[model samples]
Target: MKELDCLFVYPGAPAGKKNLLPIMPAGLLAMAAYLERNSVSAAIISLPSALDGEFDLPGIIRERRVKLVCIPAHWHRQAGGALRLAEQLKRAVPGVRIALGGYTASRFAAEILKEHPAVDFVVRGDGELPLLKLLGSLGTGGRSLGRVPNLAWRGKEGVTLNRTSYAAGSATLTGLGLAGLRFVLNRRLTPRRGICFEDGMFTYVQARGCADNCSACGGGRDAQRRMCGRRGVALKSPASVVRDFAELAAMGIKEIQLPLNPLPSDAYYIALLKLLMKKKLRPVLKIELCGLPSGKLLKWLGRALGPESKITIFAGSGSEKIRRLNRGRFYTNAGLMAALRLASRLGVKAWTAFTTGLPFETRRDFLATAALVRRMRREFKIGRSGVYVFSLEPGSPLFEDPEKYGVTLRRRTLKDFLAQRGKYDMGYSTACFTEREIVRNLKFLEKTAR
Candidate 1:
């Protein structure tokens, strides 16, 4: 048995998405690395696998003997589960300090602190420095409570709050250091039945924050700066990102997923691809494009990753109208199809996401979207497609001003969300679609995909 100070927990949200296979806790991985870099011994736990009876977490906690447990609540979908996991851990290891961090947790810190007694601390913004300080001050009997920044703690004078920074400048990818992906490769993390790729795939990040303003997404540019205190999108060097991938390849992780924002510069992307081409990375890389790509970029991607390397595009919605409303202002269905057409020609796989009953979505538009999805699958010959029900996110423009978009926003209160069956689930709770319509569309999507 080893004595440890902290253990990071990845609270999985299986019910939120139709397919949770690709939902890796990449942020927790990065944060773990950050902690390790600060000379703290840490390990990440999976709440999903634990719930599914894959491992004995209570036993593991006793064996490891950690003083503090940090469960990251980045996605709102995973927040409730994360809180529940924290409560369970507290009960298992009595007196073990519990904390939560990441986007969702930061956005809703006040209410979470008021509600969850098991959560001793909540990291409000940039987590690296604050977490490092918190760990250093742990076991000191409240001697250093005020020193830790961006922390909400259960103080003697009620919940004591500290200065929290929202700027990406305060905490950047470069500052957090390496992607601690290998930590998740443990057999304990594997479910009885998981995706085959889960056994080998590794997730990495190139940037923090996004510049686009997708109406329904809370991580949009405006939302980030206004609510999250994240200013500009902080990017890491291509050399740094490529170096990490190369290291992963050497470590026997051939399939690397770079879940980055659309790279800030095309030249940077070209350079990254060129560097990747030079390395001995036999990688099946998955990248989420912010928008449709140009022919040149597609050619660059083809040259960088040969036919052996599988590519998966994260394009959501094949309908132009839905794209404008939810995805971004610039990208169109035609542009997306063009990229897929190029991808098909280059022998690469792509994924186009779909949302039924969006704001201003007529039955005609839904039909058009369905038709386009079918066309992408059969005609353009893209790899795969997915469909989902549209629900307003807490931080998105659509959530703030539902009337403007012809959509009614539900789940405004923390109580509403906590009470919901699938709190952060992207179920059809929008004014645009009835619950029946959502269920029917879900069935239709399943049928089409089959």
Candidate 2:
């Protein structure tokens, strides 16, 4: 371990439609950028996002001589695969360290430590600092094993919980050299099936996190704490923000996806848009929009964005009460209608999302949602962009306060879900809703997609 050289590997996602969802592990890129900034040599291999199939993992690790392995926990599907890789790497190199992070790792540290004994440690929060610190400790052969918040280590006595504080929003996004890291991965994965999207489009952090306390969103307060151990949304400086996007635009990435809700105000967003336009680039814009845009605002955007701008709104729930329950500042149905009317008038293809079976929702609410969807389709002629229904994510407010919403919480072992992932025809059912209702509503929603 003379060289502070490390390899960051992102665990793969559940394989499904290949073209529609080409995976690129943003975390791995972030980790690589962090390690590189510390004057350490780091390389990232995003297995899920790899163009090469799973069969190529062994060769890649061998060639890279990977010392460290970092992966997030939601990528539970890759556990078996990652474990096998860890075993091989240790045998080949004799002292490889395996680290895990992300939502899954933070929550299920015990389960992962038990299941994958090969894993050296599990990182709890924003991983850049923890990873660097852990590597520094490993490099020096120091074994104090003091508390490191957001880390769980395996030792003689099962697992040791270190109070090493989980850090987030700690580093400057621009200072990380994201552009350089992207270039590195791109070169390594060139001419492969689907590498990084090198088109005139880029997705940067308009802000690090979200402000709206939507119960189901990952960025919500309780959810963020549970997931990343952070309380508030960590936003980047505006200069950094504009600089990153301008760099991406210069790289020929025209289209950009901004944040979901509680985004920058009209002035901030408009200014950013004008700056991009001043660069003489026209790109498709996707945003997490909510509530209704005023006629004046719509007209301004329509005139400013001209023909190339497209906005995507994620309403999250059609049931206003459910929306309110989920901490969505409920836009009156009138407000939603007004937005739809604006999109229709401006000839802008607006996309909206909603969910069903929100904890305490009734049949009337479901029908009301259905009716709204149908009316919007007929009135605005907005084509189908409806998300079928709601899911009770593990860290969401709904998961935390299910009882308050008249829903009983049911926990399923990880093994049960993993067993069902590969079977396409046997679609899995989560405990958020009864199997009967999910099927029925999915059928009802099919009318809109048709």
Report the number of the highest-lDDT candidate.
1
**What lDDT tens digits, residue by residue, belong to model 1 across residues 118-174?**
898988766766877888888677679788878888877887777666344524575
Q: Please list the residue runs of candidate 1 whose C-alpha ends up more than 4 Å from where it truly belongs after superposition.
A: 11-24, 47-65, 166-172, 175-200, 260-265, 308-317, 381-384, 390-392, 422-428, 445-450
Error of 1 at 256 (Å): 2.2
Q: Where does candidate 2 have its weakest 10-residue lDDT segment?
A: 420-429
Residue 25 deviation, candidate 1, in Å?
A: 1.9
- Tell me each candidate's TM-score: 0.84, 0.83
**Residue-wise lDDT of candidate 2 within 1-450, one digit each (tens)?**
233366666544433422322344355666677777787677666554445554354454556565566654544344444455566656765556778776556666777688776778888767777777777777677475454557788888788777636555624554663544552443344322233332333444454445556755545566666656676666555456567666666665656666454542455566665665566545566655654555665665665565666676666557777676765556677787777677767866667777665666667777777887887777755464575554444555655665556665443344433443331212223345464676577668657544
Q: What TM-score, to 2 decimals, does candidate 1 have?
A: 0.84
